[model samples]
Target: MSQTLDLSSAPAILFLFGLSGSGKSYVGNLIGELTGCYVYHADDDITDEMILALQEKRPFTNEMRDRYFPIITEKILHLRQHHNFLVVTQAVYKQRHREYLCKNIPNMEMIFIDASDAVISQRLTTRNGGITGASALALRRDFEQPDSNIKVILNEGDKSMLVTQLNNYFSSAQPEKD
Candidate 1:
């Protein structure tokens, strides 16, 4: 038996998570375009203080993340009320954080986006702004890899391959005739 992600019956909320420069945002945007769901970048909820800390090469402490999760949860809940389906991008590196979001949201699916260190480095070099270099490395060092149960999408330097994989993973199913 083959597992299929039926876009027609996709969850109310979808989360794309991984390291910075791993292409979570790109994947989330693509999913939104394909499914016509609203896309939300969780970074948008980042406070200026968090931005400064990141800019100063400081990774967020679990306590900080704990406080942060509620804000994101609230935003997601608000967005859920308006959109039938939603795609969200966040570097939910810790399993606890993923669990927190999952507990608060209904019918949500989380997919991990992965890439080689080389690919991440190359992508970071071209990025205009956002977490990069030491900041990114710190996050990677602190990242708690999700357990085997979570789905993984490898994005190794090829946009076409990524697109093909995503397209294959999510397919629209036609309604059955009576």
Candidate 2:
């Protein structure tokens, strides 16, 4: 049997914005589990060339970012049409990309998940067994803290607690799906 796509059931998205070691994926997963939303990590769309560059200890070049960013955004836009609520984890470092998301998506809310540099370093070290320490450091250096707009900042708490808090917040904040 063929299934029809129901765009009306799709809820608004919560964009998880953060640096590499800032726990976007972990928190997004937890939030998804807690709130029944699907989570998509932008890293999952990393190109083969970008993966090879990172594996070879080369910089994540601008050309790679320019090439892959639109692809990622397109995936998010497509996902928004299908999922009720989607938690998208991405390092939206570029202002233009942020602008595009803000302009295109309806009821899109940005949530900036951040931690201290020391905490991020610890997480990165633990995550990769310290193999990519240099790249982690470079990512930290290149990280840009997004500005406060209509966005939520989550930093001071454990993931479970924060996830619960976010779940509660969105429960009341997000509009009911049709």
Candidate 3:
């Protein structure tokens, strides 16, 4: 059977939770194409200074996350006033941060795109200047697995196959038509 996403069934705001290189951006882009929801990448809008810091081999600090959260929050709120969204961010590692978003965004839901540590490590090597294995391990350690309000937990698989599976999942999760 062909899998399809029922946009109406989708939450107004959806956050994809995963470590870096877990295909959040790729899947988000697919969702954007299949659905008209605007997909925003928090890192893409980082300040130049942050970019420079990254160039200097300094990873994003907690202070930077605090700074970006409000900015991205405001942008999401503004855009949400006009459109639905699929926001991709690495912020879900923090419970309090995720709570803030849950409280602020209406009809929001979290989706955890999970994969094994080995898989994440392998995928990292394919990207330019990807996260170090140690960093990935750190994220793994600091990761607070969410317990509630999760719409779905998708496992990492073949990109194309995963997309189709997600499409079907989203479609099937819809409430029945009247």
Give the candidate number with the greatest lDDT.
1
Question: TM-scores, in order shown?
Answer: 0.87, 0.78, 0.76
lDDT per prediction? Answer: 0.83, 0.69, 0.66
lDDT string, candidate 2, 1-178, tens digits: 1222222322488788876677787777876765577899888888998778767766666677778877887898899789877888887766666777777777777777777778777777788442276765655565565765645645556655574456445544455769
For model 3, name the residue pairs that clash.
none
Question: Model 3 RMSD to the real structure?
Answer: 3.7
What's the true lDDT of residue 131 in model 3? 55
Candidates sorted by TM-score, best first? 1, 2, 3
lDDT of 1 by residue, 1-178 (tens): 1333346545778799999999999888866665577999999998777888898898888878888889999999999999988999999888999998998898998889999889999999899987777899888888989889987889874555665565455546444559
Q: After superposition, how far is residue 83 of candidate 2 from its true place, in Å?
A: 1.0
Runs in model 2 lying further than 4 Å from the true structure: 1-11, 128-131, 164-178
On a 0 to 1 TM-score scale, where does candidate 3 land against the true structure? 0.76
| Rank list by lDDT | 1, 2, 3
